[model samples]
Target: MAYLNKLRLFIRKPFSGLCDFNRATTAQCRKPLPIWLRRDIPPAGKIKRVKGILAELNLQTVCVSARCPNLPECFSKGTATFMIMGDSCTRACKFCAIKKGKPAPLRADEPQAVAQAAQRLGLSHVVITSVTRDDLPLGGAEHFAKTIRAVQNQLPHATIEVLTPDFQGNLDAIKTVIQAKPDVFNHNVETVPRLYPSVRPGANYARSLAVLSYTKDFAEKAGKRIIIKSGLMLGLGERRKEVLSVMRDLRSVGCDVLTIGQYLAPSPNHHPIVNFVEPEEFEQYHQEGLKMGFLAVASGPIGVKLRQHCHCYGQTAP
Candidate 1:
């Protein structure tokens, strides 16, 4: 009977793209966002400058590609998280909207351009991330490190965070990123172990945990505190225990900060949101995570990894 109901919802919202999932695990639909919710977003001070800098650097933001709800608020603050390694992605996760295609050769100049953009925007803290680039031998680890170095050199005062790929679990690549030493080192273990094939088909659940643990271990060995952070999206058909399991995994690696946000499918072709998570539920999880040992926790209807609220604090992942 529940299956029939979910099927009906799927048919009515054909663009929801959850056909690939089993209905039983998903949550029931919640109320939609109010019109006022859209209108009340914190403003991005000057969009002209935001658009102009993006055009100048010829760069793309996960804000635009993933259709983040937080874009307006973050850009209004004169801060933007830049996506590196080209717009093309090697992995085809159901939740992501970044383009998937054969990647182009790396441009030798992107590192400097991103740094210059951060400087131009006068960003005191910048978030840098990229689509997974499996085609590259080191999984684009060198590029991630280089970009961090360039940004730091240009703005010594800027607090830089690199939301890096797992580099297919290559310890060396992980080391390379840690060596560059961004203020915050982040890798999203996007979902639970069971959902790997369905939601994150190209990513490994365990490898991600290992990467986080190893990153901290390496940093500790070098005596450089690097705060390790990770995020997960709700409304992806995961159970409460499953989410809790992920939290435990992250804690095992001593992840300092955590983000739990509602996952909204980008388009009809993307993974359908199993439900629209309610603000109260997010609050519940936030409170529970504090019990579980996350130093800084952000979980709400509006949580994201690139905003003022997204900054994290931890032990070695300084």
Candidate 2:
């Protein structure tokens, strides 16, 4: 069946380009995943229970939407990163697995639904994220703030973390989320600046950095010691120097935590993986980040999702 599919693809393209494309795909398939990337699927019962609960509440999770490899493990533990503002994203990033198109109208009940789900799961640390809603005037910042407040109302003791979009560099929108007083604020830069045109076409590198800088500044001026976090994915054809430069850029903005992980292309149609960065390379970045004064760094092949390391800086912070 796979061979037939390849043959069909070959027939659809010019013969000269077909050979090169087939060779690249074949080579990619031949290369086995690194040992560190392998996983043992967790018990289905626990995963099913978590999914059933989410289904009952009509809550969407980036875990399920993004096809995260860590889903089963995280679900078995009864935790999820709630994806608010609906499942459809406004931006069409090449690497993300989330669906892209016109999204549904913002749901007024989603905030309470997310809060109830977190309380039912008894989550001590809650991570809230959303699809890019560029259509909205404030880019869904108010919705994010409402979700944070709802969760706070239901679980007063739980620490809230929000991974937000750039909001098109709107400082007012950024301030809306910051004023909510989330314990941690995360905005993933996702990749090096050079790759932005191809990797994250809808996003601007400078705008992303500015978003982080403004969030850090606004929160501090408000007398809130909120942790500012950002992340990048390696293996997107980014050079080591570029990766380090991004780290420096984040540090310049007072980013408190950094999450670096190998990029796994969601599909062949997405950005092709240029490399499978080694565990040793990840460790080198981890050590370099610590030396550069990052409060905490999570760098590795797997289990490197931002949510997994939400509390890392807290543990290391004074």
Candidate 3:
């Protein structure tokens, strides 16, 4: 059956962690990049400058840790989505490229380091995300709050956005971050309900939805104007109706922003990309999302996740 076939693939390839994931697979690595997803190679000097600063500050970014296709371009522009709470993740999400295993001890200085990096980069808007640290008591929620406060203290005028883990859907943990008052609070459901078991085994579909719902309610009661946001990765064999249903669910919970992007498998060991979604279809989703009441929508094959519209509300996307 399917399980036996997958077992055979595992035995054959063994996922040595050396395979290039930006391409589909070793056998298909030479295939040309899709026309819709292609990008101009970025200049190295600006990218190097950003990387040097991050290195000096001992900061990490999701751009590097997750092998984002937009890294070169984002770096050249001196923008990075900072990744805190260590590089390793406790959960083994099959779709993500981040190393899945025991994470190192949390760095007590990381919060201030991220603020310093943001200040050095001269960023007007900052995004901070983390690898899932399920081993921690509050799932690194307090660390998140501290980092937000640090950034706020260092760059009082800058807008802060946090893409956080579900904290196993702990209401107290969710409240802890909400109380920090990030301008935007985001937690991606990542995919449809049916694909949860395969794509994100450790994440619960309903629980993820509740994280957004509760944050919105909590922030409202606290009288904070925090925007609740979520996103999805398409082309994992998801049906169009299923994607729409996910959007409806997000709207029901008052999600204010949405990002839809194509799923790129990190390596042969990861889940394979079912198909590349079309540019026109991305446009359709973009329009549909706007109609669904999202304050902003960024849907495309390339740079969807990094688009400025995904970062803050009411800003014209570059």
| Angstrom error at residue 244, model 2 | 0.6
- Model 1 misplacement above 4 A: 1-31, 34-45, 303-318
- Candidate 3 has its poorest 10 consecutive residues by lDDT at 12-21
| Candidate 1, poorest ten consecutive residues by summed lDDT | 13-22
What lDDT does model 1 reach?
Answer: 0.72
Q: Which rank order by TM-score, best down to worst?
A: 3, 2, 1
Comparison by lDDT, 1 against 3, better one = 3
Candidate number of the best TM-score: 3
Prediction RMSDs, each to the true structure: 11.1, 12.6, 10.8
For model 2, the superposed segments whose C-alpha errors exceed 4 Å read: 1-31, 304-318
Q: For candidate 2, write residues 1-318 as lDDT tens digits.
A: 442332222222211100101112222333467777777888998889889989999999888787776676778888888999999999989878789999999989999999999999988778898999999988999999999999999999777889898999999999999998887788989899999999899999999999999988888788877878788888889999999999999999999777787777666778888888998898889878877877667777666533322223233211
lDDT of 1 by residue, 1-318 (tens): 442332222222111111111111111223355332244556445766797899888987777666665565556666677988888999888877678899888889999999999999987767888888989978999999999999999999766778888899999999998899887788888777888899888889888999999998999899767778888877878898989889988998889767777676666566766776677777777777777877656675552322222212332211
Error of 1 at 210 (Å): 0.6
TM-score for each candidate, following the candidate numbering: 0.84, 0.87, 0.88
What is the C-alpha local distance difference test score of candidate 3? 0.78
